[model samples]
Target: MDNSQRIVTIKDIAQELKLSVSTVSRALRDSAEIKLETKMLVKEVAARLHYTPNPIALSLKEKRSKIIGVIVPEIANNFSSNTIAGIEDIAYKKGYHVLIFQSHEKYEREKENVQLLVSRRIDGLIISLANETQCYDHLTDTIDKNIPLVMFDRVCHSINAHKVITNDYFGAYNGVEHLIQQGYHNIALITLPLNLSITQNRLNGYKDAMKKYNLPVRDEWIIHSPIDVVCSEMTIRRILESDNRPDAIFISAERLNIICIKVIKEMGLRIPEDIAIAGFSDNPITPYLAPALTSVKQPTFNVGQKAAELIIELIENNNTTTQYRTIQLDTALDIQASSRRRQ
Candidate 1:
């Protein structure tokens, strides 16, 4: 017989060993009721036959696939990639597999990814909502179906689920405070749309810090630009060309920070000498910039680890009645040459 013609099964092993199919099954699973000798014999025969357990069949029987789905806005960013690494590390240790999906900051894509992951019968889901995702119907549907869900980073507060996030308010406050301590009074802010929770928190922090130092909060200096390179460049140019140009700028997003730097350099402005800058970033390249960037770094990896842990716990317990949790991790400020005044 051709070796690849037919797949080996427990029934075939049972017939060859003169044992019942149930006995073979128990032996293969190493059930406590099965004898040690029988289990060993079954393993050896299964190995020789090149038999493999079918995950599909097992999932149908146990009602679990042992796979978790993860959705992020984009995987190319340093933050998302670092978070995924942390999640994979924990999931691997716990014997669960991860399926990743990227939404590319589109609302429709985010919804579609959720549906696909659900159709695969994943044990649970971990998500960081896209900037364009405002609808909660798809998310609520997962809860109705009793599938565990955890949200991290960009999340919706209306959805009742386990959430892991950074202390954006304090992180932003620290960044702006550092600028003030360095004698930057006329500070500007480049941020995302006001609809996002992270943006709101960070904006509040910036405002509070300026108020604390009695610095004028110029409304014109605050530019609300999405994560578009063209829009960011235009907005930044307007701020730089204005008659009351800021002496320092605080960017809320890492990508925006990079754009701000590019704009500053293109305008023949020298870092710290002409204008100082600070923002939120975790890119390793921050330290190697023309003037090493000063910025706030969140515990991105830890956020992913905690999100995975929570989702797995919810899956294993299947405890619908248990209260959901929201975890907020701390952030750190890395002060570099970019934000300091020239001696």
Candidate 2:
């Protein structure tokens, strides 16, 4: 009679009420086959006994855990955090739970997390690829196993999974064009490695904008830096210190924008006076900077919400013939003092 040490089960309820285990299960699930009186009695007994269904057992029986896994590069970033909030909002309302994992931009860690989530039999997965991820065997393996997966933000083009992303090319193009409109001819670009699709698209936009305005794209002005802060700082310093320095800078990443600003301050350069700046960001702090930065703000929350909706639909449909989709959302330009030239 040690209630603290013993857990209640369907068998326990059945034995106490002198009913079959199947009857207890059916009643608990509110099946139409069970009489109303029996269903009410079983629910009352289950509540009184503090009985809870085991998720593992139920998943094994129904082949669904009603849980989805999410993987992001880093949750501390404002963009990632906002996206996660949107995902949670939709997932909660749909009667599902979300399990999150941070890849820290490491390829091995991302692989491990995907494997762990798959082993746990999650209904589906939502992922943003790590910066260091060059090979995508783990992602393809999930598809081979017939598990629904959705990739958002930083995704793999080789994978045919459903995707949600912003218009990186147009965002960068508009940002660079804003600088051009502000009468800054020599515009520099600080971007991530070209291997990434986002990086490539944004870079192409910058080039196209420069070409559109009949401005020459200098080789040295197009600097490629890793996602590391230290590396970005060094690269920014070298660019600013050079004799043929640019009058305006276009940063392609959020973190790189912060680094560029820090470097500018350390060198005692005034914003929009010495050099104007613009970048990609959705951080609230953008408007509060010493000279508020002009930025291309992607629809971070909508991206996450749409990704969750797609994955859940795929999970619920479980139809092998269902066609996948890639949803690309728009970005807005938030113009401010940083990128404006003082007349």
Best TM-score among the predictions, by candidate number: 2
lDDT of 2: 0.91
How much is 154 displaced in model 1, in angstroms? 1.1
Summarize candidate 1's per-residue lDDT along 298-329 as a digit string, tens digits.
99999999999999899899736468788999
**Candidate 2 error regions (>4 Å):** 1-49, 319-322
Q: What digit string (tens of lDDT, one per residue) describes model 2 on residues 1-343?
A: 7875488899989998999999999999889999999999999999999998988989988979999999998998878998999899899999999999999989999999999999999999999988888899999999998899999988888798998999999999999999999999999999987777788889999999999999999999999888778988999999999998899999998878878989999999999899999999989899999899999999999998999999899988882535778899999999999987647
Which number leads on lDDT?
Answer: 2
TM-score of candidate 1 relative to the true fold = 0.87
lDDT of 1 at 60: 87
